[model samples]
Target: MVEVNQFYLKFEANPDRYTLSDLNFCLNHGESLLLLGPSGCGKSTLTYCLNGLYPRELDGEMRGEIVINGKPATEYRPGEISQQVGVVFQDPETQFCMLTVEDEVAFGLENIGVPHEIMEGKINHVLEMVQLLAFKKSAISSLSGGQKQRLALACILALEPSLLILDEPTANLDPIAKKDVIHTIQSIQEKTNCSLIIIEHQLDGWTELTERCLLLNRKGIIFYDGDIRDAIAFKLDELQEQGIWLPKITQYLLKKRLKTEQKLPLTVKEFEEKPFSLFGNEEVNEGNNLPEAGLPYIKASHISWKVGQQPIIQDISLTLYNGEFIAIVGANGSGKTSFSRILAGIQRPTKGSVSIKDRKLGSWKESQLREEVGYVFQNPEHQFIANTVFDEIAFSLRLKMENEAVVKEKVQAVLETCGLLQLQHEHPYALSQGQKRRLSVAAMIVDDQPFLLLDEPTFGQDASSNAELMGLLQGRYESGATIAMITHDMELIHDFATRVIVLHKGRLVADLAPTELWQLPIEKLHKWQLALPIQVQVQNCLKKEGDYAAQSS
Candidate 1:
């Protein structure tokens, strides 16, 4: 389905620098390969090269050749490339050209000149594949982060391309949403016998599904290309040391440094039954007291919201205690954003009330509420209201009109904290996606809000950037700031969330501790389209337990 011969590229601004260098690789029919790398390492750049977006859309300097099917990528029109290779971009909103889900899915087919009769069948099949069949008529704005992503996948699938490429498709989805997207793609791949290439940070989803793995370093060159399992085990320690996402079980085994010639376990099944089973059942340790809690720092009682004539959030009630990092997760149409806006007071709840420290929503003045609740929108670009990074971070500070010296001090502190002080004078747009997210956060954090609401904060972020963001959030949480995050990263939940709230079909289905959420038997979370976190996942636990004490230690 795809071929590359000495494929390398450099940004126009920097000729000596190659975004992708000396890459020779190919993807055969029906094969699946994962392209792994750090943020700004050109994984996305390489993906664009596959469909001629490198030279045509991005307008970057290119070298060598990338052939699709049997032709060069440079020769194919973007439309012609779409017929053979479909890409679901990292940001679901950017890929959307239509206002409604059904319209968006049909848009691609119409462009391909597929007959209406064939289009309907194809759309329905693709929707069913992504488990979004019931949302055929839903508006794009009504969907949750996960739902929007699923819709993106369905659009690509409707095209029935020979090769499918997804960039961080599960970036901010809950466990349920993650599973649905994976299952949908897997089902489509199996039925159609098409090639799948995924550039993802969440490696667990692709472990069992992919046929091969391609690892990219800072230079944007392919360093490892082979069987998926071998690539994982061979680089297991290195990947983990750098906080890179690998298979959960693989990380678990590597953490223990198990004595084995075999590489780390790449899948749950292998970790369960393997040469490293000498220390079986080693993950869970002796009982440790669960942390106690108190009245939530923020409370919403039977909240409901609507936009235009359609209701987005139904009656919903939830509480977040002081110092708890809470994850509000659900599918695209599950109301995560509506709930967030309501909590942040950006959108008033239609039927219920919200309060901070027992103060009713209406009682708190707009400026007062803004001071207390910091809301970060999902679209980072929308957050940049100022020209330079310095002014953007200082906007909120200036609103207070503190002493000039005090404002400078506050802005500098946040810039240093967000790791963007060096780029303080640069245009926000020139910064990378991760840098943009940090800038948005700096805008919010410098104001010192007590309650922070971040919508999919790590969507397009790489591992290092995500860790930095998490660390920044963690500092605020520890310092008595309340955090309520909406994301699809199951690992984020496992690594940081004290509690998780799941919404399904516009209702809060589960509100429980992260540890307990993992023990639930039903697939309600699955129905919403998410998966378990990499660390606390059952497979990782099983792998740990299977090893001997020494190996497990």
Candidate 2:
């Protein structure tokens, strides 16, 4: 369905640098390919080329040739390739052009000049495939992040393209929603027999659907390409070094060096089917040890926020102590972002009060409040203001009129910590999504605020970058900074969160230690749409084996 021969590309902005170098790959009809690579490794850039957006719509120079559906890519007129290939971007909101769900789907069909008589049927069918039929009339603004993503998929599917590309479609979705979206794609591919290309960092959900894998190195060159099982079994170490995320089961098994009777298991079912045994009695700790509470930093009392008549945050009360690493987790649209915003004083509460160190939030001057609290928005671009990456981080320090030497020193240290020292001269907007996310975080952390609130700080990061960023945050926490993170990654919650706060329907439902949160009834966890971390899942699997052995004895 698609073929590339010695493809190379370089953007006009950086004429001397090649974004993609000597890429060669092909996709057969009805085949599914999983594209894995480190963040900012030209994965997304390659996607643009595949969909005929590069060298035409985007300002870039290209070499070699691309053949799609038996025609050279250059031969296709503007917007013609879209009929054969459809791409759903990482940010779903960017692709939306209509107000309502049905309208959005219809707009794509209308652009393609689909018969008006069959447009409604096509829209309804695709919506049904994505399980968004019931939300057909709903406004796009009302849909949750997951629902919006599904709607974006529906829009692309409505055009009936032969090759579908999904770019991190579930990166922002909660556990349950992520599962739902993945299953929906799997079902649609099964029914349509269309070729698929998935670019994502999260590998656990895609392992079952993808037959082959294409791995890319940081230099935009292909590192490995072959059967998914072979890559995981033979090239595990190489993949890890490249910062690619392996399937959860595979990661656990390889990390523990467990003995499996069969080949490396890529999915949970495969792990359960294969007899595996630990090398020794190595018990894994399911949670972190809770630290002693420090002095109060910020306290919220019966705070509530609303938009028009709808409540976004219900009368929630909580106290954040110095040096606390708290995680706010819940389903999409559960008000995690709203509560964090309220705490950061970015948004005023509709009712009740918030105090920082015994002072009401309203009483603090704007500059004082900003110095006291640093907020990182979920969309990194929203927080960026400076032209260059260095200027962005230095903006905070420069505002205080610090000495040039001191500003440069602080900025250099932060850029090094965020792994963005090389891109100091690059425009903040020109960086990749992951790089942008890191820059936003670096800009906020350079000043070392007493309290930090980050909304999905690790949303687009690769495995290595995620660990490094988290380690940086951990260092800050250890230095008496209070950290509250809003996230959908349960694994992150298990690994770093000292306290877990569960929110549901704009209300705080459960606040407990990390260990206690993991001990909740399965039904309760499901009610809140939460999933167990891989460590906990592996622990349960071993516990079940122990129980079976005891029964046999």
Candidate 3:
């Protein structure tokens, strides 16, 4: 279905640098391939090449050979390759052209020249496959992040391409939504027998679907390509070093170091089959020792925000103390971003009040508020204003009339911290999605505001980059900075967040310690679309096993 031989790609902006170097791989019909790599490792670039968006649409130079469906890439007419190889991008919003779900699918079929008489049937069939049949008449703007992604898949599947490429399809989805999209993809693959190339960093739900793995190093060269089990069992260390995310069960095994010769399990069910003791003598401390309550940093009382008649945030009251690490979590469109923006003073509430350190949010001058609070948008590009990466970070410092030498020192320090020093001269827009997210964060953290509010700061990050960014944020929190982040990653909540805030239907439902959040009823967690962290799950499993053994004895 697909083949690449000694492929190399270089962009016009960086003629001397190769984005992807000497990549060689092939995919047989009905085979599913998982492409794993670190941030900015040319994973997305390679996908573009396979989908015929490289030299033809994007400004890049391509060398060597790329064959799709028995034809060389260069020989295909404009937009012809798309009929054979369809790509669903990371952001589904970029792929939609129509307003409603049905119309969106029809647009793709119309472009592909499907018969008008069968277009409705095709649209309904694909929508039903993705479980979006009920939403056929719904507006695209009305769908949740997960629904939009499924609709995107439906559009592509309507084309009936032989090879389907999904680029981080669930990266931005909530836990339940992520599972839904993965299940939808699996169903499609089973029914269509189409080849797949999935590029993603989150591997928990995907490893089970793919048979082979293609690992790429930071230098854009293939590091390992073989059976998925062999790569995880034998090359675990190398995969970790490259910042690839291992399956949750594998991660637990690596950390616990259980004495076993059996192959590493990929899923929790598989792990449960093995006789292993996770807890022996040591008592599990699920709770964290939270910091003492300090002075109130930001206070919101009965905060309610709405768009026209639609309520987004409803009667939410909370206080962010000094030096608190709080994570806001909920389902997509549950008003996490809306509430965060209200706290950051980016958006005014329709009712009630917000105060920062005693002053009402509305009373603070624009300049004073900017100094007191730093807000990072979910979309990194929304916050960028400078041309170069260095200038972006330095923009905040220079506004305060700092000395050039001092500005350079602070900017360089932050650039290095976020792993963007090497790309300082590059335009901010030219950076990869992960790099752009880091740059947005670096620009805000350089100044060290007292209160920092981030919306999905680690959305597009790889393992290593995520660690670096979180580490930097941790340091800031330790230095008396109040932090609140809107995130979908339960692992981040487990590891860093001192407090977890839950929202449902625009209302604050639960606010508690991370451990307490994990202790909620399993059904309630599922209703909220929340998943327990792997660590917590393992500990719970061990507790259940111990209880059963004691009863039997």
Question: How would the candidate models be sorted by TM-score, starting from the highest?
Answer: 2, 3, 1
Best candidate, lDDT-wise?
2
Per-candidate clashes, comma-separated: 30, 0, 0
Q: Name the 10 consecutive residues with the lowest summed lDDT in model 2.
A: 273-282
lDDT of 1 by residue, 442-514 (tens): 8988888988999988776666667788999999988988888998777678778888888876788888787
Q: In terms of TM-score, which candidate is strongest? A: 2
TM-score for each of the candidates = 0.87, 0.96, 0.95
Give the per-residue lDDT of model 3 (tens digit) for 328-403: 9998878898788888888899999999998998899988899999999877888999989999999989999999
Reference-based TM-score, model 3: 0.95
Clashing pairs in 3: none
Ranking by lDDT: 2, 3, 1
Query: Which residue window of length 10 is worst by lDDT in model 1?
Result: 281-290
Q: 23-128, model 2: which lDDT tens digit per residue?
A: 8899998999999898889988988888988878778689988999999988999899999999998778888999999999999899889999999899999899
List all candidate RMSDs to the true structure: 3.9, 1.9, 2.2
Q: Give residue 537's lDDT in candidate 3 (0 to 100).
A: 77
lDDT of 1: 0.78
Candidates in order have lDDT scores of 0.78, 0.88, 0.86
